[model samples]
Target: MQSPQYLRNGEAPQQQQQRLPPHFHSTVSVQKLRRFNTLILVFRFASFCFCLSSSIFMFTNSRGSHFPNWKDFQAFRYVLAANAIVTLYSFAQMGISVWEILTGSTVLPETLQVWFDFGHDQIFAYMLLSANAAGTTIAWTLNGQDTCTASNAFCIQSYLSIAFGFAGFLFLGFCCLLSGFRVVCFIIYGFRFLVL
Candidate 1:
């Protein structure tokens, strides 16, 4: 219970203490938000590219010969369809992310945008994962068959397509984690103190 140091100096505590400029916290928070938005943009772009490649590779896998084409299998068709849908979704998300980065605000309300991203990321990621798994199973089974020996290109391309699908899923998984964190923060802070 000793007397305070400021009282001994006859100086007010507010005058003696150092205070940062009012903009300091806000500036740092803005920079953090821009960086986060940019990161999300990158992830969205990556997912788009992977999904696009997966779709393309599967689409062009037909050799027009006796070889089993991608259309011959239901799993391969699912892979193509899932990748195509995710590619479109990723492209749209990238646009939104870019808008936020450039404007420091979202086209949609912050709460809606955050929840929308989280829900879509989860759904698309799981769809891509399941499609890839199915495609890989088909590819693996075909690889073990004697017929695969005659069509090396078909097998290789199918594997490549599945690989790209998995890569897309990986990026979407990252986006999901980020958006999940955003959703939780929004829920707790109600967007007032949530920087991302």
Candidate 2:
């Protein structure tokens, strides 16, 4: 029952509609999302391990009669404290990731997570870097002093701890990159992750 007026345009409307792909606008792929989330989790866990080790190594090292303990050097104390802070933050962030995976949902708003990641990652990275630099400077100065065998051993341990702190900083850089990518995705695609 085609109307003569509609028939003037050529073929039927149903044929035109069938030519378009159905469900073409859905941008988020569940599997891809899970993979991205998992990558964050893995990176954070590695960062946590490095930070924790850095703190332990620095805190446990004794300066012998040189200064008695780690508290003797402000720089060493800063390194221990900064690493401890970053360790806790990393663990909390990992917990958030795990919760999201288990619930199959975002607890925080999508945009918030992106910015939160960027801010915290930047903050901790800088803190760790600064602490490492300070500690390394102190250790180098100590090594140059021609101290006793005990003090030299303590300086070596301090270097080892700073090394781990540097490793954590590198991992945090990766995390920042991922966060930036997420932000770009949001800007370009309006929203990539599925809600709920």
Candidate 3:
């Protein structure tokens, strides 16, 4: 019978192939991904609600009397347009979020979807923020003038619309951060960074 040969001096035995840890491809845990998906959905829905309400309030600010309406102010029109656009975007995102939640994958190709989410979220968030700022400035100026005194309802509606716009922007900003994180992880770890 022959015995197994031993390693010679200064010679090392071959090592077996080792399996990587579960988290080798992904830094975020499965639980974290689930939470993130849920958060994205919630934020998208919140944005939709706020932006929709903002648009409606701004659009309906007109009274039957001869008081100057939201359309009269360029800033107010911008606010309405921005919120309307954001509302549509948020509604679409909400559908995408629901799709991801039901299926652990994105509707579009993973890379394209991640980039799309990040880009759109950033653009719309900033758009809503700027619109709110301009609307707020106009509202403040109107408040200090006799216009607000004559039609306090218009001033109140304008402020309310702008408030909702800011709230929508805040939620959209959160979505942007989440999407940006996905983008960074993808850049570093590829699509394996998350199950999607």
RMSD of 3: 5.4
- lDDT tens digits, residue span 99-177, model 1: 9888887788887888888999999999999999999999999998875898899999999999999999999999998
What TM-score would each prediction reach against the true structure? 0.85, 0.80, 0.84
lDDT of 1: 0.89
For model 3, name the residue pairs that clash: none
| lDDT at position 52, candidate 2 | 96
The candidates, ranked best first by TM-score, are: 1, 3, 2
| Candidate 2 wrongly placed segments (more than 4 Å) | 1-28, 63-68, 192-196
Better of 2 and 3 by lDDT: 3
Candidate 2: what lDDT? 0.80
In candidate 3, where is summed lDDT lowest over 10 consecutive residues? 10-19
Off by over 4 Å in 1: 1-25, 192-196
Q: Write the per-residue lDDT of candidate 3 for residues 1-196, one digit (tens) a residue.
A: 9754546553334321243544452435655676788999999999999999999999999986689799899999999999999999999999998888777678999889999999999999999999999999999899889999999998999999999999999999999988998899888777624552
Candidate 3 residue spans exceeding 4 A from truth: 1-29, 192-196
Q: Which candidate, 1 or 2, has the higher TM-score?
A: 1
